[model samples]
Target: MQLFAIGINYRTAPVALRERVVFPLEQIKSALQALNATWGSNGLSNPHAGLPAETAILSTCHRTEIYGAALTGNASSMQASMDAGYAQCAARWLSACRQIPFSELTPHLYTLPHSSAVRHVFRVASGLDSMVLGETQILGQLKAAARAALDAGALGAYLNRLFQHSFSAAKAVRGQTQIGAHSVSIASAAVRLAQRIFERLSSQRVLLIGAGSMIEVCAAHFAAQRPHALVIANRTIERSLKLAERTNGRAIALASLPARLHEFDIVVSCTASVLPIIGLGAVERALRARKRRPVLMVDLAMPRDIEAEVAQLQDVFLYTLDDLGAVVQKAHTQRQTAAIQAEAIIETRVERFMRWLDARRGAPAICKLHEEAHRLRSAALARAQQRLACGEDPKAVLEAFSYRLTHTLLHAPTRALTQAQDEERARLVQLFGISA
Candidate 1:
């Protein structure tokens, strides 16, 4: 069995590059199905072909990663060559999925195999690898990814075990350590960006593009500032109105965004749209409407509710997940001790998880060996009992049984040794611990 992972994260690539690789939630299941086709739908590995039988993809604003396991019909039988080949295949799949050139993706990509891959996932789920250390959002993100792969029938035993272990490890990390004890940076990140763009957040008109939990969190933070005007917009006016009532802001339909886009000085969007909702053309028209007055835009969606091209507009300052991560990373210094404890917990869990994985790898061979031994023992015992029952001498029957059992046990090894070549003979002798 071989375990492999290939990915690029915020630490390795900037937001500009990250957005190009983001997988929309609606398309994740289909993407996984397409990638797993190389291996076959029945979840069996073809040793001659290096494609992975079990595969999953996790894509967030900060990272896009692929995790895979390839198990041969022969239990736990995988080679270094096979692992390396599959790693490259996974990378190519990611590149193709996002329509990015391999040459461009290679420099930023990180590929991990076996224990390293398992450890990487453990760290990610625990938030140790996140831009904001101990932020719990990553765990939710991972669960979402796992669900998508499972729904698509692209995930199986090896990956299933890996993710379940990850979840348990994360729980242990969070429960035993003070990793998430501190205040979260998520609520303040947008406000910080807004402040940077304008001299005073109080003077800016704020428009929040979604009424989900994320928008609620941001609304509270922005409400504390009491901006000049606060507006909530959603596909449904009722939901927006509820959120707007709390923030003492008014509600607007999402469709009204295009007409009134230029009215707001700050726009924060975190909708669940699969495609870009705020296009470059829309922002451009807004900029023209405002006579090129600067507007701060924070796009918190995974697939990006705001268009990437919007960042290029002269008067629009756009920030993505990676940008927000920078704002949160600074707060990590105060929680260094808690993070240290969490890392230690993760390390212990990672070792335990790897042991479980190793045991799984060895199971097929172990079962076969046990079964073969049991069959030989049963046959020998039956023959011995029959001879004794026929009134043959008891001692003779026992002796004969012992002789036959010994021969059966030694048969395979003796035959192998007899057929061995000069070099093979030396290795076989050492393997069986046979004296010279």
Candidate 2:
């Protein structure tokens, strides 16, 4: 079996492309179901169908990736076919779902195989691959993705172990190094950007456009400055109210935004909406209402909640993910020493995982041994039953049954040793853990 990861990330693609491929949280389970139907899962499927037996997806603002394992025999042809199946399946599935042609998407795509894929995931889970250096949010995103895949019944032994190892490696990285110290989450980074545009958050009003975790984190950071007013707007007023209550902000319906938009000096949004919520015209009207007072707008959502054209309006500093990347890059230099230490720890953990995988190479032999032993057990049980039916001594029957079962189990190894050549005897002895 071969493990593989295929997708686009911040390093490989711009935000424009990344947004186009994002798998929304609500859609992840269904997507995994469809993927598993085409790509087999839990080693149950028609061999004729070409698909990975196990899979998981990690979709975030900065990336969208498919991690999969192809379950097939060790034959070279089978291995090659399994490899081709998943790599193409991932690319074609993503392209078809997003309505982007493969030619247009392939340039930004990256395919990592086997250990390379494992290491990539481990690094990502540890926040090493995040756009914002050492951010903790991506770790939560990773866990969410894993949970969704598990709920979808798409995660099997290979993927389950892979993610577990990645989580452990991440813990090791955090425990052994200061890579996370003073880490600037995208939310925190957004706050810093807003600070640059305005003199003080205490003097300004802030409007949060979503009640999601990212927006909540941003709300907490901005709330710390004790803004003149903090308001949360959501499709569901109750959800917004919950968020607003946490930050001591007021909750408003998303429908109220246009009429009340001009009241805020800063707007931050991160939502799962597929279309732009804040259109250019709405922002223009809000800008006019403010008499062109500058408003800092941060769009943290993948696929974006704010229209791109709004960034062109004078006195409106619109920041999307790309702009946030620039803001977070400054702190990347300070984490270099800690990052180096984290890499070393990850390398050691990865090597340990690889060694465990190597030990699993003996699994087929172990399976065969158990199968044969089971046959012996069934045969011995049948004989004991016949003796009981024949009215053999009840106590003596039990002793004979135990003796028969033990002898049957040991017979094959004993016979094989008796028939073995001198050179093969040592190997047989080691195989059975025999002292001689």
Candidate 3:
């Protein structure tokens, strides 16, 4: 059986594409079972009847991926079957639940096979392949995906080993390297940049535009400064209330945002909405209401919660994720020392893992060697028993058995030495450090 990973992530696909393919957390197990059923069985035969291959699906805001090991099909055919199955399954699920077309979404898909897939998974778990480098959230996300796969009965030996290695590698990197040492998260960096505009975060009244994980992280960072007031606004009141309760802040419905916009010194927005949530007109009105008070705004959403034109407004400092790139870049040099240490650890682990893999690969040969040895031992014992049965002297029979066993053990090497060419014999003599 061969191991493979297939999927797309924030690096390879845009949000428009990602959202279309993203699987809800609730459906992941079923999705994995469906995929395994489709690929493991030949079409003419029972489509879902074969021993289902080991499979797992990992879907998050940043990426959606599948990892599996199967016995019958080659990589190409398996990948094609997976893609086709996913398209059909995704189409049905999306139409029934999300009202999206899977066909239109297929163009943006990416499929990684074999070692590339393995490398991609390791890099992802290690945070080398994230949209935000060294982001810790992806690690937890990966763990959750692995758990889901296990629950679906899709995790078999190969995938189980692969993921265990990946988890260990991620931990090693985080513990040994300074890659995640700096406060480079979009939220934290946004706050830092906002500090440049305003002298004190404590004096700033911050308005958070969403209640998602990113928004909560930003709110937590901002809360440490003891901001004057923090307000969370979300499309869902329950989500906003949950986030607001954590920080002793207040929650507002999304409908109330336009009216309440002008009361804040900073705005950090990240929403899952497909369209811009905070438009130029809203910011313009907010600016007017604040009597031209400078507002530092950060948009962390992929589809962009804030409007692009908002940047053009006077006395309004608008920053998108791209704007925070400079701050994130500044930490790269600072993290180099940590990265070097981490790479050394990764190298050692990689070598150990490769040795393990090589040992597994040699298992069949080792088994054959054991079987041959057992056969020779049994044959020698049977001959000794026959001599005893024939009333031969016990001492004679025992001596002959020992001699025969010694000859049997040494015969192959002796024959090879005798049959060797002159040059080969000379090399063998040299290898044994024997002077001719």
Candidate 4:
């Protein structure tokens, strides 16, 4: 079996495509089970019958990817199988759960296999591949995905080791480099942008959509502003209430969003919904109801919670995650020193990981060498036992056995070297570093 990772991220695909593939936290275990069942039945199971090939998925606002191990004839076949499986599974799941089409989605996908996948995952964990460079949130997301895979029994030695090593590499990078030291995350940047729009954030009423970490973070930032009122609306009422309680805010059911939309001056949404929750009509209605009061809406959702057309509305300021790029750019220079240090650390860790991979690749050869030696020793001991059983002297039997076993082991190498040509003999001697 070989290890592979295949999928696209913020750099390779746009938000439209990334959001279509993002899996909700609650659905991860089932999705991993489905993926394992799909691939295992297709001849991707482990050769040793120890465990099924490992599978884990990391799906966040910025990226959607699968990391797995599969048995295949070659690298190309492995890549093809992975791409096909991801496209097929993602389409089916999204269509059934989110009402998205498979055909409409497949074209936007990107697949990276084997070494490239490893490199990409490492880069992502190290914060080099994030939409907001040096942002540390991806590491936690990766860890969460790994835990989901583990819970679903889709993780084994190969993947467990790979992810652990990847995490260590990320830690080393953070420890050695300034990569994350001065980085301002998207949540913080959103707050910064909101400040530009309103004179006092404390006077603004804020509505946060979705109860996930990103939204929770934005809520915390907004709460510090002491907004006139803080509200959380989530598809799941329990989760929404939990977040609302934490922030000293009120909770509203997602279904009531239309009725509650016009009451807020600032809205920040990051949800797992595959479709737009805040459409042009909703925003238009909200604006009309508010008598054209300005509303700053930041959509952190992939695929986007707020429709693109909402940005065209006169009194609406709709900003997606992409729009906050410039606001966070100033910190890039501040983080350069950290980034350089982190890269060097990652480089060292990468070499160590590659060495470990190489050693694992040579394990069979090492095992075979020990097996051959044990066989030779067992055979020699068996012959000596037979001689002793035949009433031979123990010392003589032992001497003969030792002589025969020593000769047997050295005879082949001696004969091969004796028969070697001048150049071949010299090469062999040099290879073994023999003085004579």
Best by lDDT: 2
Give the local distance difference test score of model 1. Answer: 0.84
Better model by TM-score, 3 or 4? 4
lDDT of each: 0.84, 0.85, 0.75, 0.79
Candidate 4 residue-wise lDDT, 24-123, digit = tens: 8778899888766765554435443222367888988877777876555555665566555544554455455545576665565566666666666788
Give TM-scores for every candidate, taking all chains together and pairing residue i with residue i.
Answer: 0.81, 0.83, 0.71, 0.85
Better candidate number, 1 or 3, judged by TM-score: 1
Between candidates 3 and 4, the lDDT winner: 4
How would you encode candidate 1's per-residue C-alpha lDDT over 1-436 as one tens digit per residue?
6787888898898776787888877789888877776445332355554447688889887899989886644323444534445555666777787888988887898878777888899999999888878878889989989999999998888898899999998999888888886645666888988887789888889999989778998999999999999999999899999999999999999998999999999999998786888999989999998998999999987667888888888888888887787788788878789888888887888788778877886888899998999999999999999999899999999999999999999999999999999999999999999786
Write the candidate numbers in order of decreasing lDDT.
2, 1, 4, 3
The lDDT, on a scale of 0 to 1, for candidate 3 is 0.75
Candidates 1 and 2 compared: the better one by TM-score is 2
Worst 10 residues of 1 by lDDT: 73-82
Q: What lDDT does candidate 1 reach at residue 238?
A: 99
Off by over 4 Å in 1: 39-45, 48-51, 72-84, 196-203, 238-242, 245-248, 279-294, 307-316, 388-436
Q: Write down the lDDT that model 2 would get.
A: 0.85
lDDT of 1 at 206: 95
Local accuracy of candidate 2 as per-residue lDDT tens digits, 97-177? 899999889889988877788899999999898887777778888899889989898888888888999999999888889
Which should have the higher TM-score, number 2 or number 3? 2
TM-score of candidate 3 to 2 decimals: 0.71
